[model samples]
Target: MIPAPFDYARAGSVEEAISLLGSDPDAKVLAGGHSLLPAMRLRIARPSMLVDIGRIADLSYVREDGDRIAIGALTRHHDVANAEVLQQLCPIVAHAAGQIGDPQVRHMGTIGGSVAHGDPAGDLPSVLLALDAGFVAQGPTGTRTVAATGFFTSLFETALAPDEVLTEIRVPKATAGWSFMKFQRRAQDWAVVGVSAVRANGGVHVGLTNMGLTPLRAVGVEEAVGGGADPASAAARADEGTAPPDDAFGSAEYRRQLVKVLVRRALEEALP
Candidate 1:
């Protein structure tokens, strides 16, 4: 399927990309194009213009910033998975990145693009949510930070304004006690259900994927853990606040049950 005809403009920098997006109210930013291109081909998205920001080299790095690790928005999934700094400080992120799609997709997909797409089935967003990461967005006004908890608002919708471009992702240094579990019927397929659990800040945090309109923190599970509940007891609450989707992959009820099992396994591994 061919995408509807649209104007294209390559941005040399983030500022140029923001300006291009501002030039047209219906303009969409293009990074790796993994998500947007498919939506366009299906005619689900028909932006009048595409502001290509794929060539912005400055926004493709991973580095340490004091007690946090800052990842440039354009950093590829492959790089994020392999970056030594992330491997040492935030291994769950690196592990989750490695589990996304396959090698080709990892090579082409940008962390920023995946996060900005706001897909509920995306593996990284759930990990970021459990870790309580922060996203930095830049627009005409200036830069502002959005917490992962509030960043995702709905299915394929985010708190980012139309003119805002996500520039960086910041995660706290979580050295150990973390696990990411994804359940899929086939290799490189989207997760039917996923769980990310990390022990940080004197407590355990849990995030769920494909269990709601947006990636969601398993608040009930987290609260249970905080109250000194065992892994099985904490995981039993996995379906308390979720609204999993019913589709070809699995039924919502199946996912609700699966999440409980995965959460228990993840908690056991993370809290061991």
Candidate 2:
């Protein structure tokens, strides 16, 4: 398959990338190109221009800031998976990042790309949601922080403005237990149903992947946990508000049952 031809502009900085996006209304920002390139090849994405931000060196770091760990948007998944700070402070995120695709994909893909792509099946978004992470969007108007809960609006859709560039991700240091459980048919494949559970603020926070139009919080499970329900009872509510797609690998009903099981496993691993 051939993609539509597009003009290319390599940005040296985040502001420049945002500027390029502003100048071309239909331009797409290219990071690792893992997400956009595939869509382009399939003719599902047809942008007039591609603003390449992969060369922006400053946007590829993982550091500690105040009570949070800040990860630059360009930080590669491989780096994230091996980051000492993330491993010690946020092992769930590191583990999830490592589980994405394979070694080659992890080496090329970026945390910013995964989060910004807003793919429902992506591993990182659900973990971020469970961690209550925040994203920093930079544009000509300056920067604004978007909460993970609100960042993902729909399938392959995000709250970022057209001219904004996701600059960094901020996650609070995890002082409690956390776990990620993914049910996949094959190695390095997308999860059929994924569950991320994190003990936060003295309560359990759970997020579901490929369970709805967007990576979603297991509101029913969260409420059940808050109300003193056991893991099995809370897990039973895993499908309460989800709308999983009925694909060939599994039907919606199958996904519902899978999520319940995975959530229970995740909760057991996350809770003491």
Candidate 3:
């Protein structure tokens, strides 16, 4: 289907993009155009203008910041998957980034775009949640940081305001013992159920994908593990708080069962 007619403006910097978005209430920011373009083509999104930020070169980088790894918003999945910094410090993130879609999508899709899109089925969000990442956003007022725990609000919803542009993502550098498990119908397809597990501080952090309105932490499973339950026992609670969709992939009950098995496998692999 043809996308609705819209004016296009390229932003030379983050400030310019924010100004363009603020000036036009209906303007959508375009990064890699992986998420927004598809929505626009389907008529699910009708914007009067598209503020392109692809030319903002400063927003495409990966560096170490004190105790965290700073990733710019425009960094592509292909870069993230091969980044030496991410691979050495956070292999789970690199592995998940490499597995998103096929080569074409990974080469064009940006991590910031994936996280900001707030799609429950997106692999990166669940991995970011497990890594306890933080997002930086810039708007007319200035920049602010939002934790992954509160970044996702609902289905296709996020904490970012209308004129806010996500600038960077910050993830801790000390995480280890990580595992990312994805269950899909075919190669390059969205996951039927996915689980991300990583050791943080002293306990395990677990995030579930496609099991709720947003990427969700498996708190019930975490609690069980904290209480000294075995991997199988902790995984039994993987579905305790989720409300998965019943659609073409699988029923809610089927997802519930899948989560248990996947969580168990993930825990067995992630735990020391």
Candidate 4:
């Protein structure tokens, strides 16, 4: 079905986009149109205005900032996959991006849009949570930083205000041990369960995907790992805090079981 008619405007800059959004409460920012457009066409999302920001080319690059890497909001999945810096410093993101969707979706979906959308099943969110990235939002007042740990409040919900636009993501530099494991019934389907891990200094962090209302870190497992538990023993705590949902695809119990198995596999790969 065709999407409902909507007004369109291409913002020359992020400030322009923010102004546009500020002008209309129901206005939506169109980054790459990969997620928003599909939702619109299916009537799942009905914004009165489409503020196209894809042409705001200035916000579409990757750079190093001190010990962290700053990725512009409009950076496409393919760009991140091809980024040598991310591959060297945060390969887990690249690996997860490579596994996001088929080539077409990856070719157009913006990283900022994906993270801002706050889909618990999306690979990027869980990876960012595991990496403890920071999201930067710009608005009429000024810019503010939000931690990935609390950015996502629930499925399809975020801490962003209506007048604000996410402009960039910051990932701390770390060439540490990490792993990303996902289980999907089909190649392009959302993960039944996914896990991301990163080892730092002396401990490991593990984040669960599609397991709860939001991307969740398996902190219990991390605590165990920190306390010198064997990988096998630590992974046993993967579902200690998660409450997976039951659906047509699989039961909640099945997802919890998958979390245990996937987390175990990811921990083994992340262990030094």
Candidate 5:
């Protein structure tokens, strides 16, 4: 299938991108275009205009900002995978980013684009949720911070407004002892069940991807573990609040069970 014909424009700055999007309701921002372009090619999505932000080179960096790690929106997965700073500061995100699509996709997909897409199956959303990451967005109104948990709303939906552009991601640097595990039918496929666990502030945070309508935090499981529940017992609550969809790979019941198993395994891995 061929994508619908659309006007194209390169945005030189964040302000320019925001203004472009605000000028047209049917415009879409292009980062690496890994996820958006495929949908466009299939005609599953059609836009009147495309505001290409790939040319805005400033939106691609990883820096230490006080107690937080600041990630520019256009940072590629390959960059994250190979960064010595990420290796020492947040190994889980680096490791998970490496496990994203194949090498080509990693080189082309950006962290901001993946998380901003708000796919329940994407790895970064769940990991960022577990790490309590914050997103920074700029719009005509102003810039504001959105916590990761509040950023993901539904399937392919996000907190980003039509005229807003996500500029950066902020995650606490104090997180340690993190583990990311995804169970897929094959390599380079979306996870049937994925878990991101990290130790923070004397408690545990766990996030579930592909186990619900949105990337969800396993609040019950976290509380159980923090309350002294054994790994098996805590993991039993992994599916307490999920609504997984049934598809070619697995059913809701099957996914719930997988969540339990994987959460238990991940908890053991992170806590050990």
Candidate 6:
């Protein structure tokens, strides 16, 4: 399948990308294009123009900022998976990133693109959610930060405005007990059910992938854990507030059960 014809403009900076997006309501920003290109190829997205920001070299970095690790929007998955700061401070993020797709996809896919794409099944969103990360967005007016808890709105949708470009992701330095579990049928395949668990703020944060319309926090499990429930007991509530999809991959019931097992394992690993 071929994407519908569209005009293209390469943006040299975040400001220029935002301007290009603002110039046409139908314009779409192109980062790594891992998510957008697939949708375009299937004609699910038919933007009138593509604001390519791939050449914006400044947006590809991973650095330490105070107690947080700042990752530029254009930082590729490969880089995120191998960044020394992320590897040491937030190993869950690096571990999950290293599991996304294949080598080619990892080298080309950007962390910002994955998060901004807002796919419920994406590995990073759930990891970021579990980490309670912050996303920096630059729009025509100015820049603002959105918490991970509020970043994802719905399936394939996020809080980012049409004219806003995600600039950086900030995650706290979480070097304590953490675990990322992804269950897939084959290597490089999307997760059938994924769980990200991290010890934070004296409690456990749990994020579920492929369990809802958006990357969802396992509030039920978290509450159970907070209430002194054991890993097995807490994980029993993994499917309490989820709407898992019934597809070829697995039925909603299967995912519901799988999440319990995965969450239990993740909690066991992530909890002291």
Candidate 5: tens digits of C-alpha lDDT, residues 1-272 = 88999999999999999999999999999999999999999998899999999979999999888878899999999998887777888888889999998999999999999988988999989999999999999999899999897899878999999889999998887445878999999999888889999998787899998988799999999999889998899999999988998999999999989999998989988885
Backbone clashes under 3 angstroms, per model: 0, 0, 0, 0, 0, 0
lDDT of 4 by residue, 138-193 (tens): 99999999999889998789999888989999998867799999899999777888
Worst 10 residues of 6 by lDDT: 88-97
Which regions of candidate 4 deviate over 4 angstroms? Answer: none
lDDT value for candidate 4? Answer: 0.90
lDDT of 2 at 16: 84
Candidate 2 accuracy as TM-score: 0.99
- Which regions of candidate 3 are displaced past 4 Å? none
Task: Provide the TM-score for each candidate, comma-separated.
Answer: 0.99, 0.99, 0.98, 0.97, 0.98, 0.99
Q: List pairs with backbone clashes in candidate 5.
A: none
Measured on C-alpha atoms, candidate 6 has an lDDT of 0.95
Q: Find the number of clashing residue pairs for candidate 4.
A: 0
Q: What tens digits encode model 3's per-residue C-alpha lDDT throughout 150-218?
A: 999999999999899999999887446988999999999989999999988678999999999999999
Q: State each model's CA lDDT, in order.
A: 0.95, 0.93, 0.93, 0.90, 0.91, 0.95
Cα RMSD of all models vs. native, in order, equals 0.6, 0.7, 0.8, 1.1, 1.0, 0.6
lDDT of 2 by residue, 1-272 (tens): 89999999999888789889999899999999998999999999999999999999999999999999999999999999999999998888889999999998999999999999999999999999999999999999899999999999988999999999999999999959988998899999989999999998778999999999999999999899889888999899999889998998799999999999999998888888
For model 4 the TM-score comes to 0.97
* Cα deviation of 219, candidate 4, in Å: 1.3
Give me the runs in candidate 5 sitting further than 4 Å from their true place: none
